[model samples]
Target: AQSVTQLDSHVSVSEGTPVLLRCNYSSSYSPSLFWYVQHPNKGLQLLLKYTSAATLVKGINGFEAEFKKSETSFHLTKPSAHMSDAAEYFCVVSDGSTDKLIFGTGTRLQVFP
Candidate 1:
């Protein structure tokens, strides 16, 4: 079974500081990974994705993730965080057999002024 684990349950950053949300995944075969963010009362928005094409994948809102097959990690990072960046982030992996998504517990990002 494929699974994803979010290393941090909570991450706090300043409005202009760098943000790092760690994630690790386990799969029997090549996996499709994704990062999704959800703001208060908002739906899950796709941040970035990796599907065997490129190792480094960039997404919207200055967010990006590098797929490291050797380490089995797909950590999300941003050069700087904004006040609007405060939200919940999820690390998801696709199950090869059923094409179902396996989501992480989630990491809450709090951006302080």
Candidate 2:
């Protein structure tokens, strides 16, 4: 079985500050990891993915995560937060062979000016 846990349900940041969102996971086999961002009332956009490839993965909008096998953690980070960055984020995991995906509850990012 594979599952993901998002440590925070919400994150608030001021414009131009850094952002961090924590996540943890458990999987029987090697897993595929992903981070997705959803803007207000919009569909999820793929932020990044880890396919047993790179430990340090970079994504769009200056977001990135490191896959830590020891801690089973993959935390998202951004150097600076933008007002437009206010949205919901999800940490996701997929079994190496399945089409189904498991999603974190969600983290709502509030950006203040």
Candidate 3:
């Protein structure tokens, strides 16, 4: 079984401040983790992914995440926040057994001016 947990249901940040979104997971096999962003009234967009190759992965719009196997965590971060960054983020895991993504409870990011 593969499962994911996003630590925050909502995160509020100033436009110029930093952003952090925490996530944890458990999987029976080596899992492929992903971070996806959904803008208001928009479809999900792939932000980043962590396979077996790299522990640190960078995504668009200055977003990045570090995959920690020891902690079973993949936390998303950004150096600074933008008004356009306001969106719903999801943490996902896939082990290939079912070829389906196990999505975590989404974390909505609210960016303030």
lDDT to native, each model:
0.94, 0.94, 0.96
In terms of lDDT, model 1 sits at 0.94
Best by TM-score: 3
Winner of 2 and 3 under TM-score: 3
Model 1, 21: alpha-carbon shift in Å? Answer: 0.2
- What is the per-residue lDDT of model 2 for residues 1-113, given as tens digits with 9 covering 90 to 100? 88999999999999999999999999888988999999978999999999988899999989999999999999999999999889999999997678889999989999999
Candidate 3 weakest lDDT stretch, 10 residues: 93-102
Q: After superposition, how far is residue 64 of candidate 2 from its true place, in Å?
A: 0.6
Per-residue lDDT tens digits for candidate 1, residues 1-113, read 78899999999999999999999999998899999999999999999999999899999999999999889999999999999999999999985568489999999999999
**Candidate 3 has what TM-score?**
0.97
Model 3 deviation from the true structure expressed as Cα RMSD, one decimal place: 0.7
Estimate, for each residue in 1-113, the C-alpha lDDT of model 3 and write its tens digit. Answer: 78999999999999999999999999999999999999988999999999888899999999999999999999999999999999999999999778699999999999999
Better of 1 and 3 by lDDT: 3
Per-model TM-score on C-alpha atoms: 0.97, 0.97, 0.97
Whole-model alpha-carbon lDDT for candidate 3 = 0.96
Worst 10 residues of 1 by lDDT: 93-102
